[model samples]
Target: MAQTGTAGPASIATGPVTITEVVQSALRDYPQIHVSQEEFNASVANIRLARTAYLPRVDGLAQVNRATRNNIFGTLLPQNTIPSISGPVIGSNNGGSVWGSATGLLVSWQPFDFGLRHANVKAARAAKDKADASVQRSQLEVTTAAADAYLTLIAAKQIEKSAAAAVDNWDVLLRTIHALSSAQLRPGADESRIEAELAMARTQLVYARQADESGRATLVKFLSRTGDINTSLDTGRLLSELPPGGDEEVPFQTADHPVMAEQRANVAQSAAQLRATERSWVPQFNVEGAAYARGSGAEVDGHRLPGANGLAPTVQNYAAGVNITFPFMDFASIHAREAAQAATLRANQANEQLADKALQEQFAKAQAALRAAREVAANTPIEVKSAHMAFDQAKARYQAGLVPIDDLAQAQRLVVQAEIDDSIARLNVWRALLQFDAARGNIQPFLQAVNK
Candidate 1:
């Protein structure tokens, strides 16, 4: 039978809460989970930004300038530090100032980019997918951690209960020994031994309470709570009930894991970037159109215009042209393409080598731990039963003056240890199950089973 004890302040919740509820609460309220959600939103925005490249760019322009209509012929240095002459010396002089106004509507559209824009869009989408995987991964990690902390707190509380029960049992034995010693039926040495045992049991209870407090604190931290609030776990259900489907072997696949999915997305993104870089060497074609009306004081044939005409629309121009740019002599494009190719190769290698190896190792370890915990959980009930029987027999013998105080104390200690071990064994099985789900890169299925 399991004993119960109060280790801290009263819990705020009215009834016992399930592990699934705790995990859900953490996922909903935890700051770390919110951060991942925001990052996913940012990644979505980045995809929209990349898609903007597919649309035509339109710009509005208006400018007004006042300058002297002067002409000069001289060798002027390009540097800003050197000044140049401005008055006309080779042509007829038009030495007057005028205000010129210009307005235009310009549109530039990349009619063909040789798949460069498409690759950029694809890469951005891949990045968004990777961010989505990251959000899932974050949820899994936080949920698993919260579940572990809850189990630890539950185990610690069970230990504290057992310790408190042991202390109570020792106190009863001490009273009995004291009464017998007073009546000369038991030796004074027996009374002293019982007192020592009672003190040790009390000390153990103190340590157990400390452990419970520490475990509760960790659980509260996982829940992101402020201050030191007491928690009450559903101690009635210390062991996890198996799902209706029973404990069948769960299939493990590395490719389906979130970590692997994120890496795969990264590789895809790298490949898209490499494609974009390779297409950089291809010629880009664009269609540009502009309509503008300008006013000028000087004419092309050395004729001077009036001030009023300078502010009027004296010149109108409309242009429509196709532009083709080929960076044939740019060595930088070649080097950049090579760099992107190397990154793609590295991403592929990491996905195959590092991620695969880590996933395999995690799966193996979780499986082994699950097996060991199951075995221990199955056997601990028998151990507890035998220990209970032994302790009862020893108590009977001690009452009948057939066993010494030392033997009775030893039996009591065994009972206490057995209870603690049984509690811990059951909790370990739950922890092992949690690790198994985590190794698979998602905990939702495991959580659903437990919640059921």
Candidate 2:
């Protein structure tokens, strides 16, 4: 039952711009919006990780060693070579043998991990799509926040104007009462009554100004700018045109909503992940080739040869062929992963449905608020005019000594309250307009309608 009153945040100064312009400005400049854009950009990295599964993987290796050998095995020698034992070799000659100055590259390509590669690719694409939808949702959120801030600022300005008007009306009555009393044409009590009313009017104006200042601060914050907290805006253009009735009867169509779209994309991505997990039963394929060469020698228990020379037989070998693998018994783990993904997909689906329902509720509530605001606004003008007339009669009666001073004061209070009500009603209309715009996922049409 929270009501939209004429009081809101302060109005910002503009040469001649509408609420839509303010909203655009806020969206473009807000820090929150920038943060969201950065998040969307970061999400692209997830897509890259997913896509990497399909690409070939390669590795290179190298090693060097110089160590004592206890019982050495002779090098690849001729089958007829006889055993020549060097006697009592404690530490033999410099017989350092280098295993392959062996540096080789191995490349692996999954020709058919069954459908694992394809499923990974699909999942990656889905994730990218979801990222895109997330960007849209962020945009919508920023735009909506900007619109709300703008509307609140407008309401504040309207309330300030109304309070100022009330003060002026009271000032005029004060002057009239003082003149009549000075001319000996009215009771002295009448002057005191007018003065009391004027004081209350001034107090109301101060309160209104405070509300307006608060609103302006909020607007500045929304724009991500620092400014004077008590700043005032020359909102002359805000009330230039009355906003028209908004389209409130449109049914909720979630297909076009960015939030729902993102959720759907998430579900799809999870499903693709499940498929990828299920495909894990297939074996991976690859092609490998290596060329290695290193020096060698023969040694006998803790002994080394004096002339351990020449590079080891250069073995340059290359082989390329199709490799197939079938999972022996991986059902338990693979199925578990797949099941987890499936559950996640279901959860996302449920979340999407919940979001849809929430949006529908928001739409309904906005429409109801708009209807109520319109009804309130409809009766405000007549009520304000009637209050003004009654105050005039009360003042005349007090001056002629036909009524007590308290009566005139009460009448003045009524007029001021009536003006407040009218101002609040007007501001409520603007608030309702914003709610309606947000509900529709578009505020441009509303702005155009107001312009016309």
Candidate 3:
């Protein structure tokens, strides 16, 4: 795990920030992290709602109306397109208007549904787990990105440092050749050649500086800051040696890795959903108690009630019953839903398997690349040492009038290349380590190793 950094990346201090600090800061406020967190919170709310199904529900209603009262005997189909009225047949029709009002409350509780409510709650919990895994995956992705940006800036700075050194060396050689030519010892061609070499070295320096600037801008973007201002970094220690354990293999543990865990959660969620669907068609057993009142403008003997006589709930009744009902004709739809949910569960399982396979392949590639980078990093110092020795000998010979300036220039080019290679070789290993950690679905372990 990464230690917490400052409050935010926007308020960068003058001192160099560590990679872990930068990444941890971004993790604190990155939009994706918050989005996933909110999703997890929503899933938690859903779990609460699902569990509410296990509790009793109470509803209250109150209404007042003035409408014409009439009587009829024929039955009408059960539907809501038209209003419903309840009264006995009067054997005669009349139209009269009066006030009516009523108020009531009903409480219904499902003593049990076998296990449907429990299965639904279980599915909600599984969904919450999936969302949590998604949050972890988002965090890991952000960490990987920050590591890439920071390392890119460091590598660019390394190249820029080497290019600047080459320019300085070439400029000094040019001045020496000019002085020697003026003293009538070296040829004028030596002065011209050294000048051209210095120009090329300066050009290389310009490109390296540009790269460094671009990389710094990217780093700034990742730091959640808004500007192209060149950010200063303390990369000296990072360039001095390979990170610990860069050459060795880390255990390719993936069961708890965020990617695998997220996929596994997906499978679990699907399985829970399937279970919920399977338990859905069971008999619905509910215990219901209702206390209600009725108000009617028409009397039972076909006479209109007096003014305001039915305006309030003057007649009330209480009823309670244990009702057991089943959707006898719902077999087809329930079967279809069950089949679809089962298929979804199977697909999620397959997806989990695929994620596992992909992770394994990616880990293998990362290991191979790390091995190659470590080997190159191990050998670049020798190349730098040999090139520097050759350049020194060539310079001595050129000054002693035993060799041409071209030979010394060639040796200088080799030394410059060797120096650049040496720095880049180490950075390459760091990048490889970054990939290794990314493939492992987390970067904290690598950050801890590097920072240590």
Supply every candidate's count of residue pairs whose N, Cα or C atoms clash at under 3 angstroms: 0, 3, 0
TM-score of every candidate relative to the true structure: 0.82, 0.76, 0.86
Highest lDDT model number: 3
**Candidate 3 segments exceeding 4 Å error:** 1-12, 91-95, 172-203, 224-231, 392-410
User: Who is ahead in lDDT, 2 or 3?
Assistant: 3
> Model 3: what TM-score?
0.86
The candidate that achieves the highest TM-score relative to the unseen native structure: 3
* Candidate 3: residue 212 lDDT (0-100): 87
Q: What is the Cα-based lDDT of residue 289 in candidate 3?
A: 99
Candidate 1 residue-wise lDDT, 23-115, digit = tens:
866777666777777778888889899989989999988767666655666576578884343335546555555666678888999988878
| Residues 204-274 of candidate 3: C-alpha lDDT, one tens digit per residue | 99999999888876676556544334546666446777877733565787796899989998999999998
Residue 159, model 1: lDDT of: 85
Misplaced by over 4 Å in model 1 are 1-14, 74-96, 177-197, 221-231, 240-248, 297-309, 333-337, 340-344, 392-407
In candidate 2 the C-alpha lDDT for residue 158 amounts to: 72
On the 0 to 100 scale, the lDDT of residue 226 in model 1 is 40
lDDT of 2 by residue, 101-159 (tens): 23456676765566777787788778777877776676677777766666677777777
Roughly what TM-score does model 2 have, to 2 decimal places?
0.76
